[model samples]
Target: MLNVLSILIGLLSLVIVIPAQIPFLGIANWIALPFIVVGLVIGQLSSSNGGRNLCLVIFAVAVVRLMLGGGVI
Candidate 1:
């Protein structure tokens, strides 16, 4: 159950991240970070690592984007 919830949250953050990929929209990723963190925490509580791994990947993408944008675009 927790894993499922984490995945849902990760997907939600992914939605935000997709749009944030647009130039000058990178700030949206900052907004999505909290959601991603929440998902990670929830995922950590579950027995399976799938959701946790998903969140980690999403987190990495967001962070890399942020770096490319120099924190803001």
Candidate 2:
């Protein structure tokens, strides 16, 4: 159950992240970061690592995007 919740959160964050990939919309990643973190925490509570891993990957993408935008774009 926790894993499912985490994956759902990851997907929701991914929705925000997809739009944030656009040049001027990187700030959306900032918004999504909290959601990603929440997912990560929840994922950690579950027996399986799949949800945790998914959240980690999404977190990496968002961080890289923020870096490329110099924190804001």
Q: How close is every model to the real structure, measured as TM-score? A: 0.97, 0.98
Residue-wise C-alpha lDDT for candidate 1, range 1-73, written one tens digit per residue: 9999999999999999999999999999999999999999999999998899999999999999999999987
What lDDT does candidate 2 reach at residue 53?
A: 94
Cα RMSD for candidate 2?
0.4
Q: Score candidate 1 by TM-score against the native.
A: 0.97
Clash numbers, per candidate? 0, 0
Expressed as tens digits, the lDDT of each residue in 2-69 for candidate 2 is 99999999999999999999999999999999999999999999998889999999999999999989
Candidate 1: misplaced stretches above 4 Å? none
| TM-score of predicted structure 2 | 0.98
What C-alpha root-mean-square deviation, in Å, does candidate 1 show against the real structure? 0.5
Q: Highest TM-score, which number?
A: 2
Residue 1's C-alpha lDDT in candidate 1?
A: 96
